[model samples]
Target: MAATAATLALDVASCLSHRWSWLLFALPLLGVASIGLFRLLKLPLGVQPGSVVEDVRNDDRVPPALAPAALVGTFFTVLGGGSAGATATSLAMASSAASGLGRAFGLAPRGAKAHRLVHRGWTAACGMAAACSALYGAPLAGTLFALELVRFDGAVARRLPILLGASFVAWLVAMPLAGGYALPAAAAPDPSWQVAALCVLVGLACAAAGTVFGWALRALRRAFVRSPAHPALVVAAGGAVVSVLVFAFGWQRFEGSGLTLVYAAFDGTSEPFDFAVKALLTTVTLGFGFKGGEVMPSLCIGALLGASFAALLGVDPSFAAAMGSVAFFAAAARCPLAAVLLAAETFGWAVAPWAALAVFPAYMGSTDVGMFGRGLTGRLSRAKRTARDKRRREKER
Candidate 1:
């Protein structure tokens, strides 16, 4: 409910922001640093804010005040035309709600040993499910998404009902406000072995794109971190670079969430280069410390990529876009099941079987680094460390 309301508020802010272009310059400049102004000293405007990436891997209990701070920050970020989408903000706010509630009521279960899995995990999962359901208008996928994320935690299984109820409630509340997504009539690919095989190839292509996306992100991370300048300075520089890219390359197609362009791809409006431009701008925004999630951007990229090359793959554009949409996210997130189900809910079940083919290859070949850092990369490293620790213990014994 809170997530939905905040999003609506953000929408209004975005609508109002267009009337005053100077806000674009003023907001991003003040962004995180303005938090410093709260104190009398007026320190170098360096009191930074928080986001999903910072809290998801940390304390199970988050401060209550985080919710308001994030909500206001997101509104301004979107208003400023920063290339961020809503996923990160939703997750962060959800974390705050969950953490705050747990701490407020002293709801610790199974002691500190299970802090991450019990008190924090349950709340975060429900919060995210509700937020996602509100954004995507698919209750099943939204619920499944949150459950899938916490599969590693055994405690979540017994509390599944609570998560489901919360998610459904969120969907119901958000439905009227979001109104849902609807694409115009377009050609659909007939079910056939040839088409399925082509989808497999499309998935492979998306995985390749994921690889390049990962590389660019790493390169930029290295460049930005290696620099000695203040983070705010780097972020401002990044904002400037994104603005130049948008104007210089005529990449208005890459603005906002890029969902409009994604919808247009199915109808042959967005061109092939739209994917490249959107990806570049999105990575730039993230690298520079903007607040947003990568899910929408990934979907946009996949849709454009699939539509552009569908004819080359000898398939229908709509079908290709559908395949591209799921496969790209699956590859990037390394969650084939969630990716396939998300498509099933969005595009219908028929695409799932075919999308599975693309999803499998992409999952296997996609970059180890994922959008939210919740992929096999971290799991594998953790597993390896555990094994190495076991060996060391044995040697000591």
Candidate 2:
């Protein structure tokens, strides 16, 4: 139910954004107004998926107003042509709804606080799975995503069946309402040794690009945080810059979620610098306090990057683009399993092996901390600490 409701609301917002898309002249004004609204309501500028996942992992309470605030803020941001995606907003909404339902049903029975926290975490993970399933139209990938988000543990393992069921049910409900997000079908390329070697190179390049993107985003976010200017003024300046980029610099193609650019890449119509330009626009949009998620923009960047590489390597553009899309996202989000599953689901199983070849290298090569606030290095460090603590406790005993 939570997933269905959030999907409906997001679809409506998307439709309204498309309907008013011709009002390009009003973009700056809308951007300013959108930030102003968030400020007035005392809401966070961006309800990032990473933050929400972290909150769930820590068993933090979801404030009652946050879900609705995210939805409204996302609506205004999208309507204003912010270079962002709605996936995080939907995730926030659905997770909050699930939290509320859990509280209502007393799923956290009278027991140790740890038990209640675990139950809360389970519900939140289920909600995340449901939302991802609806948005991506791949239940297994969505389930894996939620599992990855929470850093799969023994407790989560026990709840896997519940999470899987919720994800499929949400997809079923969402299919009739908003339809699955289907990309343009591309022909599978022959998996030759040469293609596999080039795929490794593509993966390395995408990992480098992903690292640069993450660094730039964090730097810009720091600058925004340290700026002494009023929030509205800062946001308005960002809007003006976006306006200049679109109208003056002829970068109108990089606006919104950049899904059009994704399609263009598959059609072999993308420019050489489409990935770089889209990355810059997305960083500025989010760093300047525009509300939305980075998932779609990351996919767009990956598609463009892959398509450009295809031209240089003489490989199939569609296949390369598809590989790039999943590989880059895997590096950026630190979710190789989910990315691999997503590739299999969206492009067919034939592309899965090649995607894995690309994805694992990208995951290993990426130097950035990742958009999710941590990476494999952090996880390893935490595990080491846990082991050390356990050994110390045993010695004391």
Candidate 3:
């Protein structure tokens, strides 16, 4: 159902972008309005858990805004060349709906509030796993992802069964509805020291890119975030800037999730300029308070980088791209295990070692801050890190 919903939304956006090219002009207004309206309604925005779940006044009760906020990612991002991935969007929406399921299902109000809240969290976890599995078509990765996202809560062991059940059912349901490109896979290459060594280099390069992207993104967000301001104005201004960039570039390519470029990278049809441009556009989209997750954009960037550098690495373009995308994305999200599994599961079992070639180093190389604001924790911006380092240095002195 989640996959179907996203496909339908994407299809609609594709039609609109093609049929009424001028609707692109209205995206800035729409982007700004979406933020203002959702805030006015106290919706969660659902792009990040910090934006929703953390806002619940009562720690025990689910936030009233979770359900509505989940929808915001889909609606806000699909309307134009905007950033955010279906994976995060689906997870947010499903988790939220699950959180509210107790009230709808009337699952025994006889239980204590704490018990009910526990049930809701468990349910949300399951929904999150299922939604991601459906979107990514990798059940284990999806399940682990859900668990990893909420690992900080420390209830992982108790809720394991519930998450597994929910993810299994969701994955089964999604098999039919998910109708599009699957992650490409390959068999592990002949084991070679050279391959292992190259993997390290790949990881380092991708990590460097992730670090730059992270820092640049933080810098941009700081300009608007550090002030008392009307969000709509800020978002609208950002949207307008994005609109101008899109028009000037004459490529809606930077808009949306930017996933197609992954395939294009494998096929050698991609332009050298795509990675940087997409990164800039995505940073702008999110920096201005445009709502959505950063995974898709990150994946696109990884694909572009890997493919572009395949010749230099003396590897097959497809193979290099496969490693690059996995490593880069893993670094971007700071999830080496997830990245390895994702690469192995999506492309081929053969890609695991090579994927690791990139994944581990990428993780080690990238900063502690990730694309999703440290995976469910408060953001630690570059400035914050610098300031902290400075204070530590003074103490040492």
- What does the lDDT read for residue 313 in candidate 1? 61
Name the lDDT value of residue 212 in candidate 2.
Answer: 90
Tens digits of per-residue lDDT for model 3, 360-382: 88887788667555643233355
Model 1 scores what on Cα lDDT? 0.66
Clashes by residue pair, model 2 = none
Which runs of model 2 end up more than 4 angstroms from their true locations? Answer: 1-25, 39-42, 45-47, 109-113, 385-397
Model 2: per-residue lDDT, tens digit, 1-397? 5445544555565567668655555656766777667667776655456677777777776655677777666666666666877677777877888877877788754342476435576787888888888887878989998888777745665799999999999888888776445566656687687789767987998899999988887777767767788767777788777767766777766766777788898888898888999999898888777667787789889989988988888887888788888888988888889999888888888888888999988888997377777765678788899999999999999
- Ranked candidates, highest lDDT first: 2, 3, 1
Per-candidate TM vs. native? 0.85, 0.90, 0.84
- Using TM-score, give the best candidate's number: 2
State the weakest 10-residue window (summed lDDT) of model 3.
50-59
Give the runs in model 1 whose Cα sits over 4 Å from its true position: 16-59, 109-111, 114-119, 179-188, 218-227, 377-385, 392-397
Q: Which candidate is the best by lDDT?
A: 2
| Colliding residue pairs in candidate 3 | 82-256, 183-346, 184-347, 185-347, 185-348, 186-347, 186-348, 187-350, 188-350
| Model 1 residue pairs with clashes | none
lDDT of 2: 0.77
